[model samples]
Target chain A: MSVDVHLAFPPLARIGDPLERVSTPALILDLDAFDANVGAMAAMAKKAGVALRPHAKAHKSSAISQRQLEAGAVGICCQKLTEVYPFVRAGIRNVHISNEFVGADKVAMAIELARHITLSICVDHVQQVRDIGAAADAAGVTIAVLPEVDIGQGRCGVASEEQLAALADAIAAHPGLRFGGLQAYHGGIQHVAEWDQRRVAAARSADKAAAYVRFLEARGLPCPVVTGGGTGTVEFDAASGVFTELQPGSYIFLDGHYGSSEWLGGFRPRHGLFIASTVMSTAKPGMAVCDVGLKGVAVDSGLPRVHGAAAADLRYTAANDEHGILHLVDAQQPDRLGERLLLIPGHCDPTCNLHDQFVCVRDGVVEALWAIDARGLSQ
Target chain B: MSVDVHLAFPPLARIGDPLERVSTPALILDLDAFDANVGAMAAMAKKAGVALRPHAKAHKSSAISQRQLEAGAVGICCQKLTEVYPFVRAGIRNVHISNEFVGADKVAMAIELARHITLSICVDHVQQVRDIGAAADAAGVTIAVLPEVDIGQGRCGVASEEQLAALADAIAAHPGLRFGGLQAYHGGIQHVAEWDQRRVAAARSADKAAAYVRFLEARGLPCPVVTGGGTGTVEFDAASGVFTELQPGSYIFLDGHYGSSEWLGGFRPRHGLFIASTVMSTAKPGMAVCDVGLKGVAVDSGLPRVHGAAAADLRYTAANDEHGILHLVDAQQPDRLGERLLLIPGHCDPTCNLHDQFVCVRDGVVEALWAIDARGLSQ
Candidate 1:
């Protein structure tokens, strides 16, 4: 009884429609801005002699992932195992999961997916290696296993070289598992909001990860790759000269959280993603109610900003689950009912998760409608 | 390229499976607690002589809506037109939208939905009324139009009595529209925290809405049905003697926001809804990482709380888009990888929107599987 069977209508806009005519709560992607971001990030990785592997969790669209691959990405990064199937089935080759695979069920799925395409998963524990190796051997497929090392994020990854050495040995002992290098990502440093803070964090991360490369080499196991970086600090990670690969996700659809941060040091890509909403009510004097709110976008990073050159003083201050309160801060007149307004989401990752498809637009015409082919596939 | 074509897998559990075997990031609904909540709220409204209309936007599942209807709920309260189709198609006779309909697309959908069953929508302006009336006239169905008044929550709704009268007049003037009294919802008061603060806000709301009823009566437009109240202040609203019906959405699955609020006065229901996640990473000494994160649950209210008899001191503190950080505050040993954990989401409404289905469990076994059929139909 899923609404997908009946929700054939209520789409915000059709192809070849102008921005003002699109329906509210539609995920609109400006191709002009999106292409620039893709090119810039790809070029940055290439100039530093690093293989670019864009994270598909940011967009969740196979078409977007294909575009990134066409732009010289060595592979696509799946945040989890369930997310890998859609991209692989949609013809994306060489999928690398940037996160961990814990249980037997997930390990079995990874082995099954590896039989079709080149599959790689991150691991920081000996048990995970044993579980994945058992499944991969049973399926007769070699799954690349990257041992994660804690650089600075403190969220995940192995904290010490001893643990990394243990995980690598466990992988080497398994027949169907190949030893991939370190997955050292300092996710917290990606949003430091200051240039020096980010640079310092990246230097620390690079030094720690490079030390792991040396540690593994001293034990007769040379680390082949070091994969980690994001939109906020990809430049620093690339310039670190120790990393062999980069995984930057959000650069294709720069959002308010990243746009407002100045830590990237002059690499301000254009904001491409927007949630188009219509003003539903203007009865409360200076405040107007829009259709999209907490359900439409992610607010953990921050509130959505009003997207317009003329809407400088207009603000989206508060939100209920489905309604956003738009305040006419310095305006002389309130926005009329049914007026369409574009909103720049606070964070692109979860905001993209809320959508089923992306209305890809160039100028005022719809170029193509891309399905978020991996939406809701987070395992 | 839609994931729907490939996402036929990854559903957490089937019927009769124990909770321990369910997949990670699954929406788990405890039917026992859910049924108790439904009965409690229904009895509370029955004692106050108020008709109970549970909001479907909370769970977004037609199965739960059917249960509410079977339990003596006066139909269901939908927040938008796209939300109405599923309930009406599923044979729920009456559906009332708690928000306003401004555009032509929504008005047309409302009119179409009205042709099949009873459809009532809220309006604060004459334009909404006129548009609905014209469409209803074309479709040959009378749509019940409820005029919204600003009842402390300064978002949406008309502010003055004169505006309410004007909207009533507009509804009466059209052959396709009918006046259905007032929608006076004081939303801000629901999360006021303190009992006295919520009580004061409810009193103010009741007083203002009662004054409007008298004003409308003196002007020859007698108010009939008054609907507005939520999980936190439903009792206060019921005792006010001004409302004929109550609309509370989140009472069935009490969330972290409502559970922590003392405004409910010791009436803490068992948390019915949970995000069942897997402990993916335990590399750190005292911190555990789960697969559920910002995309898995809403954090506008607060972070999730660990659920289980043994997890008294385990707290879910920080979150990225796809990772929840579980801190072992009191326990010396960290949670092992691949262990299942239940997370009571901060806010139930937006958290329900994240997943496509619900795993209905009872007595440690899955009783049934329900689709979040109305998920993402927020347009």
Candidate 2:
């Protein structure tokens, strides 16, 4: 729905203003915390001798992607071909679709995108590779093809080493398609809850990646690169010799789900992302409602925690489409209507997709405004 | 995030095209079904002597709102003040915000909008009334204020008639505001599953609303209108004389959750809304993935059901951010990549909010494209 520019409330606050002045249900990015997380991630990847190919799907902001690239990220990983346009348009090169591209239309889209910048995509089935190769050939563009192996996330990707070899053969046969090693990652393993469980899961996933690499190399098709690791598994993945690159999207904007995991063992990253919400209605003494809900943030991971409200026990118990229900967890601290509260989203990815722009605040002052450039580009 | 006109992909199809030609992850509105649903709702409400104030929060499309108004329905209800702008901008005079408005900025915005359109809003606290009254006074506008009483949904509403009377008195104290009616809705009761349960819930909710009316009237504070009913409870609500107006937004779009309920036993509304997704990856015969997931459609209530694939047992098993996993339930029917499949969302309201535009189709051909004019205006 298009709105008149005058009526639309884009930036919640002006530059050099405090966070309290920002409007309700606005996405807030703590720049100081964000930069620190970025630096930490960059340093970890550099020491591990692995390129940090940050997933743009996390922030979906080209501004954040620019900063990541500036901080030694090899490239940005995109989930959809349409998502690549924003980051690549902002002058970032080496765009990789970590997910599979299906159908002729979407493959053609990927082929078209390859014309502008260096593009790579994952594939499990040979038919998908054939379609991609044909499109790339038609468009006179070369696309690096990564055959994704199922590293235990029972979703997409090939199950065996033989299937991986077959996909590699399919890619080599096509003139326009180049074989670009393995795309292996256990998506569900990132949020295993238990630290020990995550470590075991990450180690097992790396073992699978290593097995895929060894099998491909012995079969005379030397795997050029092995890319796969999320925020939770990146450190464990670094110890494994197979992976040359890591894809950690949520490291910059840590969420409640990640905060639960002991994956960030020693490095306690600050909460970089928050939903700035104002109490809209106080119907009773013990209850209050905020102007942020299922539409403003996400609830798939779980209900978000009230950020920085240490004095009060204010838990986000429930959410409707446009309202978040808050209960007085601690009767000592009372909530006043119109007072602002910061929320840590249950999941950072989908929450970012819900908003159009992100307010960058630093030292209690609105530093900048960043557009979530690839907000709904899930084509 | 705003994109260049050339790069935007909001509309998946043009006019005079087949359903199969429409883009994947596109919102589809079967016009024949939509018109039939609208006619059915209007006829039912007309016979019941209760006006149908269709909730705009469901469709969020001015086109659909216009069609509903033309079908003998009263003005629609919105969830937010900013959401009211697009509907009003399209020439809808009466805009009722079913949800509470908070903060000075939002109430001021509502007051400004009241200058052009007849505005009605709900309030659960005295502070909310004070805020609205102040803004309306400054703007020189009269706002119809409804005191919200919680019948069942423990979100944002007054607990008792005494509290509601206090709010009404506060509204009467302000010259800029007028006492509208009682905002009583047991939101979750509408989807109780069993026919008897919904009837009981609806009757109880209506009883509470009737009690509020009597209490207010006894105190010399008359309620002009009593409005609250969703798709599931409208029939029972019609039996109650208290509700002068019914707000059934999702009735036009039959979803999986509603379809499972026995409430609509007599009248099985046609499935109006659909997620027209193409089978992206048929990596294996048993498993196929579609290009629709959390970002494309919501998965809060449950995963969406596959439509028109009865011969094949295709269950939408799981979802990634941009993909839907489908498994062959019957194990007999084969799914091919690029084959189009229609999906009935679990919940219609949030699903409608995810998409920017709805593709209107009639007789297997594209008819018109309608913008979801109030989508993402949850400020």
Candidate 3:
């Protein structure tokens, strides 16, 4: 039987349609706020004299990446190897795999992509270096290798200078591998609530990275680039004089978690991303249920907040697979059925991964639909 | 510029490959366990004399739905209108949208799908009834309407007998709408830890549903089908004598959240679904980072558990965007880099949504790749 074309549903909104015409539970992007965020981050990085490599893991849209490039971003950083394909296909020249990976499949993918683009990847273990280095050598293509140092984030990175040197040496030993620099990213400090605490943490991370750089320099190893920092710590890292590059992903579409944090005066990104949801049910007295839930928005950080609503006015309390329970604090003003509400997702990265495309809107009119090309390219 | 084929990316695993050869952070299905679970649920429903209409929101795979149908399921239940497209395209004749939706797009979709297959939908509001009913009438197709009653889950469904009757009456007013039955699913009680408490909650829900049925019958309305129950409360709901059909979605792939619950005898479903993850980072002592994280698995319920490992031995303590922090309790048995582990996801539905396809494995080898066709069709 022929597959019905309707099964592969059309985009939620057309270009000329109004905001109300867009379907519910859609990932809506405000183009005005987005353009301002892109401009702000680009200008901040240029003034700071630090290369800005926005993490595409947040948006996963090649169109957004192209806009970032046009706004003067150096390159884009992806969290996975497979995630880099879309950007590479979209003509992004410089790409870095921010996380480490193992296995022959990853090595083959690295070699395949390195042939076409300026590819760089991180390594915490010597085995990972040897695996990719060998494949790169066989392919006769040079791949940039950055040894991720565990400055503070204890998840993925080399803990000691000895281990870092070994990984660097392994990369140097291979003919097709080049020592890129040190990756001193501390993901834990990105969401520190207090400004002072987050600044101190970023300073400490920079200090430790400086120490690693000194050790590598003393051993006659050139540390060309010291790339790190996130949306929370970008200001501190850019001013630290230790980090040569800033990798801030969430600044373009500030999520609820990032919005809750106190940012420096120069760089507070606007809330451009939102989940357009409809009040599907108003059954309970103080509760209203919306169509967006775990499937449409990511709740890993916390529950999403209603856009432009005060903390006391409305609160999203619970989320099921396909429903979000909204607690209406104002008893007199009840949410009507079919009433549209914009939800600012708690976390932007994984929330972008949950949707197929973004319904880009400008002045309450749908402007474009950017495909989340790497939505499920987690492998 | 032409889009590269590699940008689309291929499946993580191929048929006839060994399980270890499958790419990391892939959704893996143990076909043996899946067959057993499907057979067990089918046998129980047959013995209980209740129609088995498994929910497709959990799997979202037409291949699995075909298997469920072959195992004697009457039809399938979808959480959204868009989600039914794949199963319908695969020739599943019966479908029930077990949730409420609004908008002209949904009505158009309902009308289009009802033209080809037996389609049933739920509603707690008269507007929804009128919206979909008028469209169905104009299209000259009869769509079954099930007025969802608030059995206990306060998220959706009509609150009172008056509201339920009004919705049913509204459905009857349209020439193309038929009062199929009442939906009395209590989602909150599905995850209750204690079996006794869950049983009591299920019984209460059944009692409330029976009352609504009587009320409707006294008013000369036919309550033909009483469908509501999940994997956690299937046994209780089937034995309650009030529900004519059971809608258990997660039984085919018992997740870590459901596995932690206490189940009655004769109704324990084995964990048939898992995330095949490889340890990518072992930099920190007493800790290992796996490839599966928030993007690969759903952590809304809880963190995924290491399959076949004791709670004290290995624990998935934290989840980042693309990394799972595995806390090694057994000091001597640290997770090695490149080592593969099966992860039982915290919740199956959202976790399944995060993947593109299920790597079906049997006898430690990949048997097939089942596309998660309706994965992001949450509109």
lDDT of 1: 0.85
Better candidate number, 1 or 2, judged by DockQ: 1
Which candidate ranks first by lDDT, i.e. highest? 3
Give all candidates' CA lDDT scores: 0.85, 0.83, 0.89
Model 2, A45-98: lDDT tens digits are 898898889999998999999999999998999998778888777777788899
Every candidate's fraction of true contacts kept comes to 0.56, 0.44, 0.66
Question: iRMS of candidate 2, one decimal?
Answer: 5.4
Please provide, for model 2 over B148-261, each residue's C-alpha lDDT reduced to its tens digit, 9 standing for 90 to 100: 888877777898877887898899888899999988777888778899878888888888888889998888877889988989898778668989989998889987778788
Who wins the TM-score comparison?
A: 3
Candidate 1 regions exceeding 4 Å error are A1-10, A263-268, B1-10, B263-268
In model 2, state the lDDT of residue B182: 81
What digit string (tens of lDDT, one per residue) describes model 1 on residues B1-379?
2222343344668788898877788899999999899988888888889999999999999999999888889888989777777776576778899899677778767866776677788998888888888888888888888899988788888988778878988998899988888898987889888888888888888999999889888988777789999888888888899999999999999998888878445345678999889889999988888999987988998898888863776688898989999887764765577878888898999999999888999998999999888888877
The local lDDT score (0 to 100) that residue B126 gets in candidate 3 is 92
- Between candidates 1 and 3, the one scoring higher on DockQ is 3
List the candidates ranked by TM-score, beginning with the highest.
Answer: 3, 1, 2
